[model samples]
Structures are given as structure tokens and as C-alpha cells.
Target: MTLLGPAEIRELAASLGVRPTKQLGQNFVHDPNTVRRIVRAAELTGDDVALEVGPGLGSLTLGLLEEAAKVCAVEIDPVLAKALPDTVRRFAPEHAGKLHVIEGDALRVDVDEQPTALVANLPYNVAVPVVLHLLATLPSLRKGLVMVQKEVADRLVAGPGSRVYGVPSVKLAWYATSKLAGKVPPSVFWPVPNVDSGLVAFTRREPPQEDRNEPSQEDRKATFAVVDAAFAQRRKTLRAALAGWAGGPDVAERILRAADVDPGARGEQLTVRDFTRIASQRQSQAPHG
Candidate 1:
């Protein structure tokens, strides 16, 4: 398949009257090497059905079509969405049948068929939420690679106790294991972003299992609530930070103690499992029976 270069990209954009918009975070990738690297890092197999978000100008989409059995691209912009199919037909006619385009918001798009892998140059502004949402919505996504802003990449792959560890890190850990695969220079994009981009590669894993009792959906909700509340006041210790979430400071202390976590510890120090334990304690202490 022919990949889009600087000339072809510019020509297509000019034809469609498309200019990269800051609001959409549209920095189109024009480097052939960058697109090839992203596709290789994704590790797509012949059986894989890939879901690509914000496929601006079909650069990555063309690369994905080369590897994946089917490429379902979700684009928010109507012009690019309409132009993508014809571009594919012109550039990679043999693979045209493998391409499916969905014109809508990635966050709200309903994917009827579960994609075996995800590959995208995600919009920098909404990268974290979009990744988290797709992982939660599609159970069959076993693995994938995404190119995002460098700082966001660090946060997504950050582990407990790391300086950047917080909400994105913990929540992402609840679904998949992630690592920084590589970095892309700013020169690769059409409207070069000020900051570099990093590739975050991830493999989905089962949620932590309960040894004796099964954790329910309510347990997940309660744990996420604790996570949000704890980070909402990052400066405060767990006992004080979770006061409103756990009903009060005293009750929060008891819950922390029951979970065998130190009440003085801050939210950044706790893992998703620790938060789950705190949630379990809260549920147990509730007036029931």
C-alpha cells in the first residue's frame, strides 16, 4: 500500500479545503517512517479488526489497512470522513473493501463489532479519556499502540509512586498494561505541534480478581469514586481527602485502617488494588444486614 507523504498530504488537504484545526487537535502525520513505525508497533495480525480514532486524512488508515483484516476508522470531521473512502480507493484500491468509516465522536461512537486491536494518532486534547472509553467499551481489544502527546504518554504508563502517577495511570492500569514504545519528532506532522509525540503500547489484561469473594460493578464504581475524591484534594492525606466520599473524616480513617492502608498516605501512593480494598471496606461498613 502507498503511504501518504508531505506532497500527497498537502495536495489532498488543499483539494478538500482542509486546514488542521487547533480545536480538533489535528496535526496530520506526513512522515512515512512514522506511520510505518506506528503500524509495526501495533503488532496487528491477519485476524485482527482494528479500530482507529481521528484518522485525519487517512495516513494511518492506509497503513492500518495493510496489516489488519478490517480497519474501522472513526472520524469526527465530516470533510475528512467523506474524503477518506475515496482516498483509500485511489491509493489502495485492493484494500478498499477492508475499510469502514464512521463519522462521529470517538467517545460516543457505538462500535457494533468488537475490534481485536486499536491503532490511532489520537487527538491530544482528549487522548486519555478516549483510550479509557474504547478499552471499556470493547472487550475484544487484546492489544494496540497509540501515538499521543509525550506528557500524556508518560502519565498513561506511569506506575504507583511515580511523580506523574495519578488518575490516568491508575484508571488505565485497571484495564491494560502500558509502556512508552517510542518517540516521534515534531517534524513529522503537517502543522508541527510544539511538543514531541510518544507511542504508548498496551495489552489488555483481566481486572484484578477477588480471591474469596467476587468484586461487583458497584465495587468498581465505589473504587473509582474513592480515586476521584482522593485526587480531587491531592494535597490532603487519605483520611482528610476522602472525607466527603467516605461520609466523614472519622469514617474515612476507619475505612483506610480496615484496608490496612495508612490514613496519612496521599492518593498518588495507592494502586488501583488499594483503592479497591478501600471501596470494599466502605461497602462492608455500610448499615446493612
Candidate 2:
């Protein structure tokens, strides 16, 4: 299979009248070695059906096709989505039948085929929201390796108490364990991005909760509300930060105490489990209708 190199990438884009747009976060990967490295890091099995988002110019898509049993690519751009099948046919004719292109926003697209893994060169602007939305909606996604902005990567994998840790870290922790896989240089892209990129690798796990019971959608929604509230004002203690969410400062303190959390603690100091516990306490204390 012929992977797209720098010249081929520019040539193809020019032929298609496609200019990489910052609005779409369209810095297309042009290095064949980088593509191979990303695919290798993903560790997909032959049985795995991969879900790729923002597959601009079919660079990483071709690499994913090499390993994954099936690839469902969601492209927001109509032109790119329509052209990907042809690109695959020309570059990897044998694997053309394995490619499925869905034309829609990754955040809102409902994929028909059950994809076991997510592997993509995500647009930097919507990377976090896209990842969170997919993980929430696609329960079949057991693992993933995504390339995103370096700063966003750190936030995704950051631990509690880490300076970068906040909503992304706690929310992602509810779904899976993530780590920084590797860093990519800016020179690997067609319209080289100013900032470096980083690979984030994650594997799905059960949501954090005290009991063995399966977490309901309501439970997750409730926990996330608490997470949002806690980090809304990072400098404030839980008692003050969560006051709006819990109704009042006194009520917020009561809920925190009930959850066995310190009211004086800041949101950055707590884990996903702590947040879940606080959500549960708030629910228990609320008057049932």
C-alpha cells in the first residue's frame, strides 16, 4: 500500500481544490513513517473495526486500513468524504472494500457498525468534546489512540492534583485509563501546525462507583454536573464552588461531608470516585418527588 508523502499530499489537495483550513483543524499528516507509527501505537487486532474522525485527505485512514478489519471514517467535509473511497481504491485497492465513509460531524454522527477501537488525527479545536461524545455514545469502543494537540493530551491523561488536571481528566477517568503515548513533530504535516501534537492512548473500563451495579445514564449525567460545578471556579473550595449546584453553601458543605469529602478541598484535589460519591450524596439528600 502506498502511504501519502509530503508531495503526494499537496498534489492531491491541489487537485481536489482543498486548502488546509484552520477552521476545520485540517493539518493533514504527510509523513509515511508517522502514519505507520500511529497505527502501530493503536495496537489494533484483525478483528477490530476502527472508528476514525476528521480523516482529512485519507492519510491516516490508509494506515488504519492496513491493520483494522474494517474502518468507518467520519469526515465533516463533503468533498473529502466523497473522495476518500477513491483515494483508498487508488492507494490500497485490495483494502478499498474495507473502508466505510460517513459524512457527518463526529460529535453528532451515529455510527451503524460497531467499532471496537477509535484511531484518528483529530481536529485540535473539537478534540476533547469529540472524544468524550464518542466514548459516551459508543460503548463498543473498547480502546483508542488519537492524535491531538500536546496541551490537550496532557489534560486528558493528567492525574488528580496535577496542575493540568480538571474536567477532562476527571471525565475521561470515568470511562477509561489514558496515557500520553508519544509526541509528534510539527514538520510531519502538509501545512505544518504551529504547536506539536501528542498521541493519547486509552482503554475503556467500568465507570467509577462504589457498588458493582452498572452505572445508569442518569448517574453519569449527575456525576458530570458535579464535575462541571467543581471546576467552574478552580480557586474556590468545594463548599463555595459547588454551592450553585448543591443549592447553597450550607447544603453543599453538608453533601460534601456526607460523601466523606473535605469541604475545604479544591476540585483539583479530588478523584472521579470522589466526584461520584458527592453526586450520589446530593441525590440521596434531595427530596423525592
Candidate 3:
């Protein structure tokens, strides 16, 4: 399989009349070493079927095809999406049968066959939401690695009490255990992004079941609502932050007491379990109850 180099990427873009746009967050990776590193970090098995989002210029897609049994790439742009299959056929004819290209947004696209893994250099603007959506919808995605903006990488793996820890940290913890695998420099892209990138390696796990009973869909929604409220104002304590969500400061304190959480504590100090407890307390206090 021929790996895409800087010259080839530029040549392909010129041939296709494609310009990297900020709106689409289209900074294509042209470095072969970086592509291999991302695929290695994903740790695909011989039987693994990988799903790749935003396969710009088929750079990383080519690399994933090298390691994975099959690769399904989803691209949002019509121009790029139309061009990928032919690129794969021409560049890696031996593995062309292993590649499937879908033209749609990663967040809304529905794969007929569930993928065993996901590997992508996700668009920076929508990286976090895309990861969360895919993990929530595609249960078969056992593990994967993604390259995202460094700040986002920190938030994904941040722990309780960490300055960057908040919604993304807690919400991601509910789906998987993630950590920083490595960093990618800006010089490797066709049009370099201003910020450095980070590689996040994650393995899916069952959500915390602190109470023996697993939380239901409604329970999760309620809990996430509480989480949003808690961090809506970083400077406010839980008591004050949750006041709007809980109706009033007095009611917020009452709910906190029921949940065994300190009303004076900040949202950054709480875990997903704590948020679940708070959500349960609020549900029990509802007028219908």
C-alpha cells in the first residue's frame, strides 16, 4: 500500500479543487509516521473492522487498511467523499476491497454493520460530540484512538478536581476510560492547525453502578442535566450553581443533603456517581413523587 505524502496530498487536493476550510476543520494529515502511530495506538486485531471519520485525502484511511481487516470511512464533504473510493482503488488496489466510503456527517450517519473499532483524526470543531455520539450509538466499538485538539484531549482524560475536569470529563467517564497516548505536532498537516494535537486512547467500559442497579435512560438524562447545571457557573458552589436546576437555593440544599453531597462543594470536585446521586434525589423530590 502506498502511503500519502505531503506532495501527493497537495497534488490530490489541487486535482480535486479542494481547499482546506476552517469551517469544516479540514487539516489533512500528510505524515506517514503519524498515521502509523495512530493506527498502532488503536491496537487493531486481525479480525477488527475499523470505522474512520473524516478520511481526508485518504491519508490515515490507507494506514488503517494496512492493519485492519476492513475499513469503513465516513466523510461529510461530498467532494472528498466522492473522491476517496477511487483514491483507495488507485493507491492500494490490493486492499481496495477492504475499504467502504460513506458520504455523511459522522454524528448522524448510521452504519449498517457495526464496527469493532474506530480510528480517526476527527475534525477539531466537532471532535468531542462526535466521539460521544459514536460511542453512545455504536456499542460494538470496543476501543479506538482519536487525534483531537490538545485542550480537548486534556478534558477527556481529566480526573475529578482537575482544573480542566468538567462536563466532557464526567460524561466521557460514563462510557470509557481514556488517557493521553501521545502528541502530534502541527507541521505534519497540509494546512497546519494553530494548536497542537493529542492522541487519546480509550477502552469502553460499563458505566458506574454504585447502587447495584444500573441507571436507566431517563436516569442518565436527569443526571446529565444536573451535571450541566453544576458547571454552568464555575465560580459558584453546587448550592448556588444548582439553584436554577433545583428550583431555588433552599431546595438545592435539601436535594444535596438527600444525596449526601456537600452543597458548598464545587462541581469540579464531584464524580459521575455523585451526579447520579444528585439526579436521583431530584427525581424523588419531583411533584409527581
Candidate 4:
């Protein structure tokens, strides 16, 4: 399959009257080598159906098409979405039938075919939210490789106690295990971005819930609430930060003690499992309505 290079990318964009927009975080990859590297990191199988979000200009989409059995691309820009199939037919006529384009927001878009993997160069602004949303909504996604802003990539792969570890880190931990696969220079993009990008590879796993209990959606909601509250004021101790969430400082301390956590500890020091325990403790002590 012929991948898009710098010249071809510019020519195509000019033809479509598409200038990269800051609002949509559109920095289209123009390097075929980078596309191949991302595809390789995805570790897709012949049976895998890859779900790609924000497949701008069909660069990475073409790469995914070459690997996965089928590639379902979700592009918010209707023009790009509509043009992707034709681009595939032009460059990879043999694999044109394997491409499916959905013109809608990745956060809310639904697909009929269950996708086994997610591979995309995600929009930087909504990268974290989009990944979390897809993981929550699509239980069929078993693994993924995504290109995101370097800082965002660090947060996604961070573990508990790391300085960058916070909401994104803990939230993603609830769904899958992630690590930094590689980095891409800005020179590879059409309208070269100011900062470099990083590749994050992830594999889905069971939520860090007690093995005896099946993972509960309600538990996830409750645990995430605790996580938000704890990190709402990073400098504050858990007792002080969680006061509003637990109804009061004393109540928050009691819940923390019950969960075997130190109330004086800060949010950054705790893992998702720790937050889960605190949520469970609070739920157990609450008055049953």
C-alpha cells in the first residue's frame, strides 16, 4: 500500500481545501516510516478489527488497513471521513473493502462491528477523554496503540506515586496496562506541531476490583468520584480533600481509616485500588436508601 508522504499530503490537503485546524488538533502525519512504526507497535492480528479515531487525511488509516482484518475509522470532519474510502481505493484498491468510515465524534460514535483493537493518532485536546470513553463504552477493545502529545502520553503510562500520575493515570489503570512505546518528532507532520508526540501501547485488563466480586459499573462510578475528589486539591491531604465527597473531614478520615488508608496521605500517593477501597468503605457506611 502506498502511504502518504509530505508532498502528497500537502497536495491532497490543498485539493480538499483543508488546512490543519488548531481547534480540532489536526496535525496530520506525513511520514510513511512513522505510520509503519505505529502499525508495528499496535501488534494487530489478521483477525483483529481496528477502530481508529480522528484518522485525519487517511495516513495512519492506510497503515492500519494493511494490518487489521478491517479498519473502522471515526473522523469528526465529514470531508475527511467521506474522502477516506476513496483515498484507500486509490492507494490500496485491494484493501478498499476493508475500510469503514464513520463521520462523527469518537466520544459518542457507535459501530456495528465489534472492534478488537484501537489504533489512531488521537487529537491532543481530547486524547485522554477519548481513550477513557472508548475503553468504558467498548468492552470489545482488547488492545490499542495511540499517538498523543508527549505530556499526555506520560500521564497515561504513569503509575501511582509518579509526579505526573493523577486522574488520567488512575482512570486508565482501571481499564488497561499502558506503556510508552516510542516517540515521534514534529518534523513528520504536515503542519509540524510545536511539540513532539509519543506512542502509547495498551492492553485491556480486568478492573482492579476484588476477585470475589465481579467488576461493577456502579463501583467504577463511585471509585472515580473518589479519585476526582482526592485530586481536586492536590496539595491537600485525603482527609481535607475528600471532606466534601465524604460529607465532612471527620467522616472522610473515618472512611479512610476503615479502608486501611492514611487520611494524611495525598491523592498522588494512592493507586486506583486504594481509591476503590475508600469508595467501598464509604458505600458500606452510607445509609441505605
Candidate 5:
């Protein structure tokens, strides 16, 4: 019963009136090999506590519960939510108490410092924000194993010089060292999604080498303001894109010189270190208020 396989999944879907929500982007992974690979990639010991998002019918949830000490799942779909109790019960009869479920929007739900590791077969749309929320906001969470859109998986671990590098790649580098673990074909999912999926794992640094002050923000207004603006006109130079944040062109040049970034470079070309330096520089130069 570890997999609940494709035919059974279809049968259960019919019996439970479980229709995947188009708006919620619900895609359940029922392939046992993929689920096992995801569990193995997490590299959890008995001591590890894991949190999962969108634990639809608890497919991945069952695999996680077997490995980790605790598995707290947040599922947003009512149809799948209704089916999860039996799902959790069947796979984790021994540790049923350890499997907690929170039924709500993963995006809207505030992240908490509960488990040491957070992992999920996340819906494509919520993948980055949920990962960032746990990594950037709930710094106490030690590790993450996620199934994100294949392209986003590329971007998360993409190096500065690579084509996929952008604001998220830079931000991710400030905390955990991410690696693409596995690529999953579309056939694994029930009613299969248009795009493929990829598995990525992130282990949080104990002290998070990030400024703990720079990217770790009271309000990411300045960092995001800078990042959003830079990517706004990604082909334009960082200075040109940052014109609104730095006032006029003259000061932008001075800031670029101060940070030692090329005045001609665009957001795509800069590494996390480069962006971090620029953000720190901007924070320093702002008027003392």
C-alpha cells in the first residue's frame, strides 16, 4: 500500500469525489520510485522532523512519515484533504500522532518554526515562495527537499554565469546550498501536468552566511525593490533598472563604482555576492533617519 498505484488512485478519486483543483494546481505523485527517490534525497535520520506542503492524498506524505521523526503536512484541497486521514492512517499506523495536517493555502498560511527539515511535492505555483518563506523567514528550519517545476529547479541551483540565474538564484545562495537531485517525467502524476518536475534539496547553514541583516529583512521592500527593479528591465544595466531606487543616474554610477560592479552589466550577469554587495551598499548609503 506504499504507492496506492495509478489504478487505485483513479478508483479512490472516483469514490471520494476527488477532482484536482485547477486553481490550486493539485498534481499528486503516485510513482513509488519517485517518492522513494524523494525520500532518499532528503537524507533524513530518525531525529529529523519534516514538514510537507500540498500532501494530496498523502502519497509523498506516506514516504516521508516512514523516514522522519515528524511529518506535518499542509494541504489546501478539500477533496484531497478529505481522503488524507485514511491515507495517513494506512501508511503510518504506528506514528499517526506525528503526522499533523493543516488544511489551508500554503501561501497564505504563516510559516512556523516546528520541524527541523521541510519537504514537499509542491504545486508548481507555490514552490518558490513556500521554499523562500521557510528558508528566509523561518530560519530555524534546517533542510528542505522539494519537487518544483523543472525549470525553477534549474534556476534555484543555477550558478551566476548560467542563463537560468536570476533574483531567486541569488537569494537562494544567501542561505542554503541547493542541488538538483532528480528529474521526474510527467507520466508519474495522475492527470499529468503539462511540464515535468525536478527534485531539489537545500540544507540550511547554521549561521546562514547571509548578512543576517542584509537579505534577512524587516521588510524585503528594499531587497525585493532592488531585485524586482533589476529583473524589471533585465536586459538593461543594473544601474538603469535601479534608477528609481537610487534617485538619478549620477548617484547610481557612484553606487556601482562603490560596489565595483560593471555599470554595463544586467541583473542576469551578477552573482549573489554581487547583488548582496549592492544591497549592503545601498543600505549603507541611505540617509540616517
Candidate 6:
């Protein structure tokens, strides 16, 4: 395969009797430089285990296998998964065992338990939710470098007042210190996606904030209730939007007081810590029922 550039990728697709699946958001990278760039960005080591999703045609998987100690690649299509090992052997025969091509849906896989560097050219459809899923559920995985929709990358690292600042932004900031590493032009893809792509780096931050001690029982219910309520109507103020949810008014008020958030503020105005603090208070104020 020798890096599987676009010409090789296109020819391989023809020989393999397959086409890129739009349903799966399968936009294979045809540029080796982009491939190497993503590898360099990861800065892998023998200790690093990489979790890659949608390693279409095994191009990125080939690159990852060469760099990381272990690479677990989850591809939804069984056909693609079957083609991966032989494809990988062409570039990294020594890493046949190092590359794990799991034929399954990435959304269903639990990658956090792997305890490695999580990186991928994430399928566009699952990009944000996938990152959120891994970070939220798999605290074991330390860092992530993913190529995502440029707009999404922007939101993940957006400032408080920026248009991109919202739930994703707050959530990303709470989980990791995110940055827009680089922009990937549409031309780099085989069947170019209408939108441009960007590389996002999410490195774990140390010295965890004491405020996030895992939402207490009451807070757990209240925090989510508040989040759902506020975002239900982002344009609406907390009190107005959350009037229907239990303890939402009370929780929102106390959270605002503790976090110095405004009662009249909308959900967009609150940070991840603000929401986290609000949840804790909910448990304190309403321990029963």
C-alpha cells in the first residue's frame, strides 16, 4: 500500500469493490503529508496506546501503527476492517499485532478503558458526540487528537463570548484544554466533504478543580435538569426556561450565587464549572425525594 495516497486509495477502492460510504461519514484522507502531520501532532511513544475510529482504507491506521505502541482501530464496515491487516502489513509488517482492526461501530465501543492516547480522523457525524462520549465516560484515556469539522473544532476551543461558545465548548473546556491545531482543506479528502476540516488537540489538564467532585445525588438530577432546561431554550433566561424542571429554579439560583452567575443569564453564559457547581448545590438543598 505504501502510504495509500489518493491514487492508490482510489485504485484500491476499485479493486476492492467498494466506494466511500456517506452513511458512515467515510472521507478517506488521500494526502500522506496530512497523514504524517496528524502522526507528528500525536507525539506517540512506546507507552502510548492509540484509539482510532474510522481508519478508512487503513491509511491513518498504518501511520498510527508505525508510531504508537498499540493502535486499536474501530471501523464500522466489516469489509473495511477485513481489508486493514493486509493493507497495514505493506507499510508496517512488523506491527501486524500492533494494529487491532475491530469490525464494529465506534459509537458502541468503550475506548476510555484502553488507557492510551485517543486519536482519530473522526467520522463527521459522530465527531462531537464521539469526543464527548470518550471524555465523559472514559476518564482513563488521557489525551485526544482528532480531525473534525472545522466549525466543531472552533466550538471546542471557543471563548466565552464567541458564537461557538455553548454546551460543547463548556464541556470540552471542563474535560481538557482544547486547541485548534491545524485546518484540513476539503481538497485533501477523496470525496471531498462540503465543509473544511480542522485538527483538534485535547490534552488533559492537571490539578483537577475541587469544585467538580462528581455531582452529588441531588445535584446529579438537578444539574442535568438545569442543563436540559436552559439549552432547551438557549435564548431564554434560566428562570424562564427552567421553570418547569424540579429544583431548577432553586438550583439555578444557588448555582448562580455560588459561581457568581447571573440568575437572568442564559445557558450560554454559564461555564462547565458553573453547571457542575449548580449540580452539587442541588444535592445539598434537596437530599430527599
TM-score of candidate 5 on Cα atoms, chains taken together: 0.91
Clashes (backbone N, CA, C under 3 Å), per candidate, total: 0, 0, 0, 0, 0, 3
Alpha-carbon RMSD to native, per candidate: 1.6, 1.1, 1.5, 1.2, 2.5, 2.7
Off by over 4 Å in 1: 211-215, 287-289
lDDT agreement of model 5 with the native: 0.77
| Candidate 6 C-alpha lDDT tens digits along 1-289 | 3677888899778878879888999899989989999999987888898988888787788788888888988888888889888787767788888877778887686553375788899988889888877766665678889999999889888866677687677666766888889999999898999999999988876422436454343443455565666678878787667555534566556555665667798887776667766555545564333
Candidate 3, poorest ten consecutive residues by summed lDDT: 280-289
lDDT of 3: 0.91
TM-score of each: 0.97, 0.98, 0.96, 0.98, 0.91, 0.89
lDDT of 5 at 136: 61
The candidate scoring highest on lDDT is 2
**lDDT by candidate, in order shown:** 0.91, 0.95, 0.91, 0.92, 0.77, 0.77
For candidate 2, write residues 1-289 as lDDT tens digits: 9999988898889989999889999999999999999999999999999999999899999999999999999999999999999999999999999999999999888898999999999999999999999999999999999999999999999998899999999999999999999999999987989999999999999998766788999999999999999999999999999999988888999999999999999999999999999999988895332
Residue runs of model 5 more than 4 Å from their true location after superposition: 111-113, 206-216, 219-221, 286-289
On residues 60-122, what C-alpha lDDT tens digit does candidate 4 reach at each position?
999989889999999999888888888899889999999988999998888777999999999
Task: Score candidate 4 by TM-score against the native.
Answer: 0.98
Global lDDT for candidate 1?
Answer: 0.91
Candidate 5, residues 99-147, lDDT tens digits: the string is 7777788767765637888788888877888887777656668888899
Q: What TM-score number comes out for model 1?
A: 0.97
Residue-wise C-alpha lDDT for candidate 3, range 59-157, written one tens digit per residue: 999999988999999999999999998998889989998998999999898887689898999999999999989988888988989999999999999
